[model samples]
Target: MQGKLYAIGTGPGASDLITVRAARLLDKLDVLYAPAGRKGGRSLALSIVQEYLGEAVQIKERHFPMTADATQKQQAWDAVAADIEQDVKQGKQVGFITLGDSMLFSTWVFLLERLSDKIDIDVIPGITSFSAIASQAQFPLCMEKQSLAVMSCTADADALRAALNSHECVVLMKVYGRFTQIRQLLEELDLLDHAILMANASMGSEICYPDLRLIESGEDLPYFSTILVNRTWALN
Candidate 1:
């Protein structure tokens, strides 16, 4: 019997946000794996579904280095992939859960690239934080023929400024530590009034602020935060 590897999307935070299909698949998982940070070896996704998983099911936390060092990051991902591969090769079904849509900017991307060729991979799509944020903020992304750009703000300030200047419905993912700089750019472009910042979207820990300046003056937002800019001028 060939085991399966499900790339499950937990959809932000709320357990209900998980897709019906994803939830069903999760219920059947023999083993659950999630990315763990350096300090606390707890998986956010695992915690969300902890109540649902059976006591007999095995849970694995693959510690992923939360740093900018490229070498360390690759090593960590590779190690996780190897661990997942070991389980799947033994004909044991496993679930690799992520915060948002697995195919999106989620860490599941790394797992997919590493394990797809070795096993049967099924990606269960779930509501992305950006989509949830937009909905919560009552901001429709685009109408007709309007494009949306999804990119990470983990790059330099210049790169982020370029993206903000170029894209209209830009969903800046991973704005964890760069909120200050991003807020400054938004204010300079007079977008502070219209922009919406949704932190920890879909999760039980969620916060939204309409004023970019207000968010700028506040504390650092979680990594799950996304910046939604409805460039009304771009629609013109």
Candidate 2:
């Protein structure tokens, strides 16, 4: 009798944004695995869902190093997968929580790839940060037949430029430290006025800048910061 593993999305930083399905599962799951940046760093996913969890629910934090080194990342994933495998083998239903949707720019991707063959896996989707941001900013991501492209802010300038030119709307995720560079490129392409910056979307302290020119260079932003660029759309 092998237990199951669920990859649950806890949604963007809000406690109320968690899906009904994810909330029910979080209440019933035997163990919850949360990803942390360092050994003892706080888990954003866990923080989002903590209010719904009971006292008896077991929570486990696994370190996922924020690095470009493939070997270090692989090692961390392998170790976490092994732990999850043991729990499943013992007939304990384990839940892994991720911020935003499980399939989109999530750490659950690596875990699922490593454990899919070895166990029964279920994925529960949740609201994305950008969607929440758009709502908060009163902006439309796309309308009619307009196309949208979602990419990382860390992507090379060429790729970012191409996305800006090709897509009617482009979403740049993880825009914390690279906001300046991204804004510069948008200016070069004459799309700065059409861009908006959102940080900590849906959470307390949420900030939105419809005008990117107001953001000074070299300013530090939260990890959840994002930028939405629309070539032919405006919030007005």
Q: Who wins the lDDT comparison?
A: 2
Q: Model 1, residue 172: what's the lDDT? A: 81
C-alpha TM-scores of all predictions: 0.89, 0.95
Which 10-residue window of candidate 2 scores lowest in summed lDDT? Answer: 35-44
lDDT tens per residue, model 2, 74-160: 999999999999999999989999989999988789988899999999999989988998888877888898999999988888998
- At residue 206, what lDDT does model 2 achieve? 91
Model 2 spans > 4 angstroms off? 37-41
Q: How much lDDT does each candidate structure score?
A: 0.79, 0.87
Question: Candidate 2's C-alpha lDDT?
Answer: 0.87
lDDT tens digits by residue: candidate 1, 53-141: 76678888777776889999999989989988999889988998887787877778877888878888888898888888987878878
- What local lDDT does model 2 show for residue 102? 92
- What is the RMSD of candidate 1? 2.7
